[model samples]
Target chain A: EAEVAQSPRYKITEKSQAVAFWCDPISGHATLYWYRQILGQGPELLVQFQDESVVDDSQLPKDRFSAERLKGVDSTLKIQPAELGDSAMYLCASSLDVGGMDEQYFGPGTRLTVT
Target chain B: AQSVSQHNHHVILSEAASLELGCNYSYGGTVNLFWYVQYPGQHLQLLLKYFSGDPLVKGIKGFEAEFIKSKFSFNLRKPSVQWSDTAEYFCAVSPTYNTDKLIFGTGTRLQVFP
Candidate 1:
């Protein structure tokens, strides 16, 4: 069973510090997604990537958040000058393609805590 | 914009008890519905999905869901459950083709007791 890999299972940072999380999806997956899961709430889409190109980032907080998938393999999500409310579980998921209603496989999320 | 709603926030059940979780989506066009489960200390895993054809879809661990287009509902049901089934379940929807951005509803946390 191919599983998505994530780094730094847990993170603790100061409110004004910068934080970054990494994700490596299953091999040959062309579509990748980043989501934020607040406590007691479902995951929310932050960004979507097809290969190395971004497809949708309407919900991403561009001012402080950025995500990139170079060469369409692994991806990195960064939050600069994190705020207290930015603490949440960041999940990364991937699928075979952006179409065809493929099932997306998710990685164990990186839990962020800002104090 | 598409949105998913889960009626139950938390549910408790004993072993071998039947289970049903309500999920509704707000989208007029063609859509794909799915149910995902997250066990403690584990990542989200796909339970089942509804794309087309048969409205009733069966998934792993004896789970099933029916896609009621007229009601915009995709409710998950299981005839019998075990203590291992205790987990958080989420309902999600995405537009067919084009993009695959998923909109998920607030999860339902099920506590199955033995």
Candidate 2:
């Protein structure tokens, strides 16, 4: 099974510091998604990418968070000046394409803790 | 805005007990429904999905769900559950059959005991 790969599975940083998470989806997937899951809430979409182009980022907090897939494969999500409220599990998901009919596969996720 | 509702916040079940989790989405047009599970410290995984055809769809681990168009709901069910089945369940929906975004519900936490 070609599962999604993610690095820095666990991270702990002080408030006002910078943190980054990386994700490499299954081979041949075209659509990628980044989501944030609060302690008690379900995952919420933060950004979506079709290849290297961002298709939707309506929910992304661009002021402090940024994401990019430079080569249309592996992706990076960064949060500069992280805040205490930003502590959560950052999940990366991907599908064959932007079509919603296809199933989305999720990575193990990066758990971030801001103190 | 499109939203998903999961009425059951938490459910506790013993071994061999039946299971049912409710999921409702507010979308009048065509929609795709799905159930995802998250075990403790595990990755979120697909349980089942409904795009079209038969309303009742079966998934891995003896789980099944029924998509009721009239009720705008998809409820997951299992004849019996095991202690290993304890996890959080989330219901998601896409406004259209093939859209770019997937909206998820708050989620329901299930705790199973032997």
- Top candidate, metric TM-score: 1
In Å, residue A15's CA in model 1 sits off its true spot by 0.9
lDDT of 1 by residue, B1-114 (tens): 788999899999999999999999998798988999999988899999988899999999999999999999999999999999999999999888544877899999999999
Per-residue CA lDDT of model 1 for A67-114, tens digit only, reads: 999888999999998999999999999999978477899999999999
TM-scores of the candidates in the order shown: 0.97, 0.96
Model 1 CA deviation exceeding 4 Å by range = B97-99
* Candidate 2 chain B least-lDDT 10 residues: B94-103
Q: Judged by DockQ cut-offs, is candidate 1 incorrect, acceptable, medium or high?
A: medium
Q: Report per-candidate DockQ.
A: 0.76, 0.78
